[model samples]
Target: MHELIVIEHEAEAGLGFFAGWLEGAGVRCEVVRPYKGEPVPERAGDGLLVLGGAASAWDDEGYGWLPATRALMARSVESGVPTLGICLGAQLMTIACGGTVERGTAGLEIGAGAIEPLPEAADDPLFSALPAGPWRAVQYHYDAMTALPAGAVRLATGSQYPNQAYRLGERAWAVQFHPEASAGIFASWTGTSDMDPLRVADLDARVREAEPELEATWRPFAEAFAAQVAME
Candidate 1:
């Protein structure tokens, strides 16, 4: 069976529905929790999946495991290992591969937001099968990937953040949105935020309403990543 090394940076941002989708597609996941003192391995499994986190990608001092995680990401791209980086994971990948990430000038892009696939996405291994035109996805990030690595193929773009998704080399992919997040996970994130209670409820309700569409859109995306991992 194809196995993926999943790096979980925080308790709140675990794999959630993405894990289930990958497993259903026949990929085994081995999660590494560096937040609880688990050492980040140099290498393990057939592919690598780095999840989103509360910490910024450049905050290696605050999150001690970040340097090692970035190194692992760089190596994964170098060796052409199937890899997926979400949100903060994507930022880490960007910086690790000579790109740029910074706090967004447009402010936090929270709740369900529209993502439009670029022309290049029609040829992408994972994004080619997605629905045409714009689609909604859960977004909760203060930082954005302002620049992508050299030679990276831009796959998708959002109104707030232009670099929403891109492919590095051939096998490594990065996305600024949370395709793995369930409504509950998103609600948990809002609960910890400083947003007003009414606003939080509205956001939560919107995500809950968008749950089916999120599943329809992202499940195939997750499975496509799993299939890519299995091929290696």
Candidate 2:
């Protein structure tokens, strides 16, 4: 079976629903928890999956394992390993490949938000499956990729963040939103955040209502990624 080397940076943000989606599509995942002292591997397996986290991608000093994680992501992209980076992982990939990431002046973009696929994504291997119109996905981030790598193809955009998703080289992709996140996971995030209790409840309720749509949209997306890993 095809296996993806998953770099999970935090406990709350494990693979969540994505693990089951990938496994159901016949791809296995071996997760490496850097927060738990598991070293990020120098190389990847059939594919690489770098999940989101609370720490900023550039906080190597504070996170300690960030430098190695960035190095691994760089190597994965350079070596043509099929890779998918989400949120913080996307920021890491951006910085690792000479792109820019900074705290969004627009503030935090939490809860379910609309993501519109760019014309460039029409032919993309992973994003081509998305609808032409705007679609909703879970989001929880303060930083944004303000600029893309030199050769990266912009795939998706949003009202708040234009660089929502992009493709680097032939095998790697990055997304600012959390496609792997479930409503329950989102509630966990809101629970720990400093947001008002009423706001948190509203956000949680929104995600719960959007759960079916999230599954319908991202399940095929995960399977598409697994298909790419299978071809490797």
Model 2, span 151-189: residue lDDT tens: 999999999889999999999999999999999999999
Candidate 2 residue-wise lDDT at 186: 94
RMSD of each: 0.8, 0.8
Candidate 2 lowest-lDDT run of ten: 126-135
Candidate 1 versus truth, CA RMSD in Å, comes to 0.8
| TM-scores for candidates 1 onward, in order | 0.98, 0.98
* Local distance difference test scores for all models: 0.93, 0.92
* Candidate 1 residue lDDT tens string, 1-232: 7899999999999999987899999999999999999999998579999999899999989999999999999999999999899999999999999999999999999999999999999999999867775989999999989889999999999888899999999899999999999999999999999999999999999999999999999998999999999998
